[model samples]
Target: MNPNVTVINPTITEDKESKIRVAAYCRVSTNSEDQQNSLITQMRYYENFLSDSETERLVSVYADEGITGTQMDKREEFQRMLKDCRRGKIDRIIVKSISRFARNTKDCLSVLRELKELGISVMFEKENIDTANITDEIMVTVMGGLAQEESASISNNVRWGIRSKMKNGTVKFHSAPLGYDLYEGNLIINKREAEIVKSIYKMFLSGMGYDSICRELNESKVIKNDKGTKWLSASVRYILTNEKYIGDSLWQKNYNTSMPYRKVRNKGELEKYYINNTHEAIITREEFEKVQELIEQRKHPNMNLINNYPLSKKIYCGKCGSLFKRRFKNEKSYWICREHYYNAENCRTKPILEQVFYTAFMTMYNKLKANYSVIFTPMLTQLQELKNKKYGSNKQYIEINKEIAQLKEQTHVLARLKTKGFLDVSKYIEQVTEINAKIEKLNRELRKIVRCDDEDEMIEQIKEIASIIENGTDLMTEFDDVMFESLIEKIIVKNQTEFEFNLIGGLKFTENSIDNCT
Candidate 1:
């Protein structure tokens, strides 16, 4: 038997002689020329490496450019390669390194386990490790951890550099805002966009809410962000609150957290820099501050009310002092007291036709236009005199400003204490809340004083109202929604037929509704 021990080779069948379908994945975290070149070289190397092997067939060379490896979901090509592997179109994957494949340890191990389960293998050329030949994942795990740490280090360095630039007031504006263009790291106001920005601020100041402004823009087909995107209330609010329009730059209003990163509002979590006169002004500081105040005042817990119809939250039942809610009957809109709408027995107020309010507004506004010289002109002069009288050396104003500054400084101190673990979370929150309350109170007082200082704004508003009326069509044949929002503050149902219109500047008028207008 030992003499007859001749080796017999096993028959290799044609069905088992299929070539291994190999795929390569390459990625560059940035779009720089050097990284692009590296990516191309990696793709070429994989293609040549597989082409030289008779048993391996090149399936694809997947490449992701200008994307982060920390998040696997963001890498399109990497995901595609995995999909191909699951589809049995790939038997092996070749990557330059673990970091190139994924800088996240968990994502790396998860994908590796999935590939191994599918009878597929992954080769890390730089690490000289193959998922199929590995007895355990300890080496891969350690390598993945190193890659993750490296990514974290790189992120920290980039953040530090950006923060350094922010501190030195030398940070480049990456993209120009709606009204400006970035040229040589400077923001230059685009003339046409600047006009739109100004109009937004003006509209807000004129009592046109965010929804109204958005509607006006969209209905007029105003282009935004150089795209024909539809206007949104958020877009209007951003323009209203952004300091960039006021010739100032505020950096670090938002910041990104460490690995497993998230973008969050700064909210005292980090230091912010404010540099004034960074560019040409599209809106004055005073106008911006006033808009901020209006925004705060208009904030309602019920967001639906913020963008409701023109009469929403503006009509009230004079008898029960309940808010009027919009209702529909027979395909017509009516404003009924909330109490009456829910339980008719609770309130006796009748539902008023929505058109009545519109007609009332037109009538009231026309009257104001006719009596502009008699009513608004004298009132404007008085406001101007009062404004001039309080123009210099306001001790109360100075004291309030000082108090606000001190309170703000205290907040910074509290933030630092919390960061240093000197204050417990609950206690820190309590103290900050108290400090904010005090600051808000002082700010309210300051705003009152500021309002007095803003008689010029009121005078300008009065002039605008007069101009709209003066330029309006004779007798106002149609109900102007814009005029209604601009002039009237609220409407009160005095009775079934009588409605009282409260104007913005504390003026009131009564009008009788036309019978069966609805």
Candidate 2:
């Protein structure tokens, strides 16, 4: 018989105890009792389901209770599961539905792709689709899009209800504002807080600045915010500027905008409603308007009534590092160190003519423009390298995790040995302490590596700087204060004739003034 042809069936061996580890993910968007019960039910159902399957073992049940599906960062258990998945501790993930996994289409797809790369399978029960099943990918995408649209529809409906209430002046206030108490859908004056509000307005009109008013409130120790914190200048300012004190309701002064909703100051984004005499007045309308005028006057002190100049608060005295304040001398704008102008002992930096300063700034800015590519090229190249470079392999991550696990197991063994009188107590303590320290060091290194590996933020920063440069071709020809502000962080005046220009991208250049002091 030919030796190659004589074949017997080879006995294949496999780890019989090894089972596919399955983790169930559940989420509820609210802390309501009903939602909590539903969450508990999900946990129990998943536990029983996993327990009944002989081929599968329950590794973990990750549940994000009272967390919105829109925000993944807020889901602690969900993040932990992903971290575990990355560590190869999980083989499969099961979720109640795709909407429960993520409502955002992009978030859902991105997470699925990441999981796919890790060779992990996700089963969405409602969709009855397994991500490991390649044919269901299209269905998953379509369902994800539908879920996102559903989420957007819900958001829009909620917004419509809020806007309707706002337009009718029937909007609900979650918490009573300072000086007002919410009773039966109406704002009634809180006697104690109203007195404080009135005092804040009176003090402002009486020539006491916000700082002084805040100081007075603190010293009296009678006025405290809703949080029981001492009065701040900003808090005093809020009371001074609030039109609600004058019995007018300015609804929609701020509104939440965009997905992942951030509250933004309503600057003509939506229609604002101003309902007069909507509540009890803490201050008279005339007084409120007069205070507003006073505030405006303080804000815009120039003869032309400009609120702020290009370098209003950007100039810093090189010697004293104090902000240079704008002043007028013989109808000519000049900038002097505020500390030096107020108290000569604090700062003695001489004043510089605004015209002279601008000329010097332009000259330095022109020089920076001339060498823009040369100056930023090396820096940008390094950033590009960093952005393009592949981060450390997952092998290292796996190895580190394995080492951590081994260290943890050794610690447990040390405890057992000490308890059983098999090892010296001193040796156990010493070994455990040493292992813990080593583990901590490894953890720190791991965190550092992870932080460095994430180049998204760095890439964004680079893109932002690149865009500024790309759009700033005409930067040297004209004096655009906004552009100047965006690029230049601060202008340091070394002297009346010498200056340093500090750009936001960390490039600093010096220029000598050609104009002489008159």
Highest-scoring model, lDDT: 1
In terms of lDDT, the poorest run of 10 residues in model 1 is 299-308
Q: State the lDDT of candidate 2 residue by residue for 1-518, as single tens digits.
A: 66666668747645434789899998887666698768767877887787778789888777777656678888877887999999999999999888889887778989999999999999999878888886456777899988777777776876788789888888756546799999866889999889888888888788765556766987987646422344544456667888889888888877776675655567686999887778889899899998888776654335223424657667898898889888878877788898899998887787788778667766766665667677667777787676445543466766787798788767756644553458886888799999999998878665555544435344444444445554454346544443454556678988778888876435577889868463
User: On a 0 to 100 scale, what is the lDDT of residue 220 in model 2?
Assistant: 88
Where model 1 places Cα greater than 4 Å from the true spot, the runs are 1-19, 44-51, 54-57, 181-192, 218-230, 276-281, 293-518
How well is each residue in 203-319 modelled by candidate 1, as lDDT tens digits? 988878866787799798787742233565556767888999989999998787777876556768799999888788989889999988777665432232333566766888989
- Model 2 stretches astray by more than 4 angstroms: 1-21, 30-61, 65-67, 83-90, 117-119, 135-142, 174-203, 208-236, 243-249, 259-263, 273-288, 302-492, 495-518
What TM-score against the true fold does each predicted structure earn? 0.53, 0.53
Give the per-residue Cα lDDT of candidate 2 at 358: 66
